[model samples]
Target: MAFGRNKNRRRQDAAQRNEAVKGAVRSKGPGVMKVLALTLATGLLVWGGVELRRWALQSPRFELAAVSFSGLQRASRVELLRLAALTKGQNLWALDVGALERTMLQHPWVKKVEVSRRFPNRVSVAVTEHVPEALAVLGELYVLDEEGEPFKRVTPGDGLDLPLVTGVDREGYVADPDQARQRFQAALEVARAYTKEAVAGKPERLSEVRMEGRDVTLVAASGQEVRLGEGDSEVKLQRLARVRRELGARGLAAEIIHLDNRARPGWVAVKISSPVSERNGSAKQ
Candidate 1:
């Protein structure tokens, strides 16, 4: 009876151990399956992303169909397109937008450029060109923009109808850029103010604005010269208009009008070939 009881207890313990082993395996099995599923999902995502990129690179749907440009004046469309080296049927995703913009900026007339892709097949290039406002002589003729910045070298294809600003040379500009810009700016200011004035019932065009240190002398297309001093350009220009109007009514023309008198404020000196040409007075505007 004792041996049989001992054998029954041993059988019960073996059964319990087997159940615990099975229960532990059941808990660990789901954890292992979850790890494998997560790993497979991650691998599929990576593969899908790589495949999408490859497809986009060679897809006809992403081919470059059209290229558009805006704000182009001095820069021709053909020139810019040649610089970009983009062809129709080329994949848009393959083009480097940053490199394309830098290439476009190599053109002398292009001041600012922005390149963007219109999804599915188009690219646009918007450019801001440097507008030539005047011509300056700095060892070589250069085109000056509205900001008095010399941007481009003068070419035969460029328009030459703009006013000329002289006196600052290339050496001076290279040594002192700020000084040069300020000098050009002063001359440009005078030119802008003179544009609104006319002489002898005819519109006088500003031909040249010669800078001599701080002094400014304006030469018109009509061969009329005005000796304008520094500062108060607009007010002095108004006085110049009145002088021209008075001279025009009197059937006379001044070879030179001096409104740069520092000693006598508001005084003007008019010089001409006629007998009534020697005139000086407070020609207050």
Candidate 2:
């Protein structure tokens, strides 16, 4: 009876151990499945990223949709459109925006450019065109914009009433040069200001404003010369404009007004040229 009881107890213990082993195996099976699922998910994500990049570069869905511009007058719409290499069928993601911007900036008239991508199928471009402030008659002929930047090299366009700048050499127009064009710029400003206020309304009011070395001279419509001295130029220009307004009614007298004096109270000299009657009387005498 004692041996049989011991055998029964051993059988019960073995059965319990077998049940515990089966429970552990069941738990480990789920853990292995979870790890396999995560690995597959990671691989799919990486593959999707690569496919997306390939599609972005090669697909035609992101092609250019439209071309637009601003601050452009001298250049026609068609001409500007032609200058841009981006067309309706060109891929937006494939284009180098930097290279395109550089090309547009080379147009002589284009001052700034902005490019943006609209997903799915659109690219937009915004451009700021250079406005010509003066006609720079350099060796190759360029239009000088407001910032004194020379751009286009075309013949003078119509309806431009700005001053014409001449005698500026090639070195003066380099990307960055000395103050060679400073004097010319000053002359241009004076001319523009004078025209805007006094002369532009009266076409032939002043014929030419010639800068000879350092001195600035103004040639009147009636063949008279007005001298503007070096330094303190704004005051000298003001004096000249005042004189022109005062004497313009008389239509530019045969006199020369010299405002070269900045400290000694300034002076104006007139060559009376002897009256016609006096000349006649002298002839009779």
Candidate 3:
């Protein structure tokens, strides 16, 4: 009987050990499944985000509907659009703003460009064109800006009244931009001085300004050549004004006026056409 009891007790202990093992396995199963569920959820979210981005990029809603321009003075809208090469129906998100900006700036007349995209379907372009201050007479005519930088090539029907700047070669300017800039500044100064109205209320309209090395020569609208030596341009211009007034008072017109001699600031040497009385007397003799 005691031996029977021992066998029964051993069988009971074995059954308890089996139950503990099964319970432990059951406890770990939910935790493992939770981890797998979290991993699957994360993967699904990432895939959905990528797909949504792709759809948004290729969607018709992002198609460019219009392109607008502003601040354009010289550059035409059609020309700028052609240079940009941006076509309608192109995906706005796919369009490269930086690339378009660089292309537009390639136009010499376009000094600066601002490119931006309007959400839902539009591109805006703002262009700042180079303001022409004068015409530089190179082999071919070119436009000069206020900073004395040549920005564009000139064509017919342009700058009819602008003063012509001569004695600077295009090749030389390209080789030495700094020196060319200085020359342009000097020419601009002379042109401005010649065009400015003096205290006598008379403005000298210049047709051409020639830069001979450091000295400047001005050709007035009346076809008189005025030689202005380098430096002290204001003083020289004042003297020129006085000379002009004196000539008008004396009923005399000069063919040429030389103010280049710095030693004689107050003296002006003028060459005038022979008076009518003198011409008549000589004819009689």
Candidate 4:
């Protein structure tokens, strides 16, 4: 009976040990699962970070693919195209707009230029060209645009029908081009006035235009000299036109007409024809 009790006690202890082993195995399985889950999450995070970086790099961000140009004068399409070609394929976000503007302004024909970027691959450029109003005969003839800025050198045989301006002082020429332009503008205004009157009447009737300080002197077709004061140009022109019309209608002749005084009636200087005695003496009889 005692031996039987001892063997039963041993079997009970063995069963308890086996149960403890099973519990340990179950606990270890959950710990391993947790580790695996953590590892998987970490791997997923790494992969996502790499993908995000690649997406950022590969995204079609703003790059210069198209260049638009405007405000260009006197520059041909070919010249403008050449100027724009330098910025092709450049990243618009990283591009230096000021630098690009300077580049265009460096071109011979470009007077003023502006550069801007459009999103997703476009660059826009606007430029103004120097237009010449007169031919400035320096070392070489340069065409002075309306702004009086001299731009290009004139070549022999170039058929630019521009007015000639002489007697520009060296200081005026060497100073700021804007100053030169101002001179050119004043001269251009005078020339335009002369041209308009000539075109309306007999073109050859008006000869040369000589500009004095705030004054213009004109030699008419009838060898009469006229003086006009500056400003009130339109009013002066109207008065001159009336005088010419009256003289033509009446067959009246004068050596001079002064429209300098708008408040007074038209004034004239008469040159009496050579007396009959003097004419006969000079006649080739």
Using TM-score, rank the candidates from best to worst.
1, 3, 2, 4
Model 1 poorest 10 in a row by lDDT: 276-285
Global CA lDDT computed for model 3: 0.83
Comparing 1 and 2 by lDDT, which wins? 1
Quote each prediction's TM-score.
0.82, 0.67, 0.74, 0.56
**Taking the tens digit of each residue's C-alpha lDDT, what string does model 2 give over 1-285?**
999999999999999999988998898979989999999999999999999989887877776776665567655546655666667778777878788777666666567877767776666667787876666666775667766666667554555555555546676556444465575577677666656646434534655666676777766666566676566556665666666566667654445677665566356544433357666543210
Q: Estimate candidate 2's RMSD in Å.
A: 7.3
User: With candidate 4 superimposed using the best TM-score fit, by how many Å does residue 285's alpha carbon deviate from the native?
Assistant: 23
Residue pairs whose backbone atoms clash in candidate 1: none
lDDT of 4 by residue, 145-213 (tens): 777667788866446766666446546678765665666677777767777876776533554455565
Candidate that scores best on lDDT: 1
What is the lDDT, from 0 to 100, of the residue 9 in candidate 3?
Answer: 99
In model 3, the clashing pairs are none
Candidate 3 lDDT over 231-282, as tens digits, reads 8787888888888888898887887888888787666788775567776443
- Report how far off residue 7 is in candidate 1 (Å): 19
lDDT to native, each model: 0.87, 0.66, 0.83, 0.67
Candidate 1 lDDT over residue span 99-215, tens digit each? 999998989899999999999999999999987889999888999988899998999988568999989999999999999998888888788777755533355788999998888
Better of 3 and 4 by lDDT: 3
Clashing residue pairs in candidate 2 are none
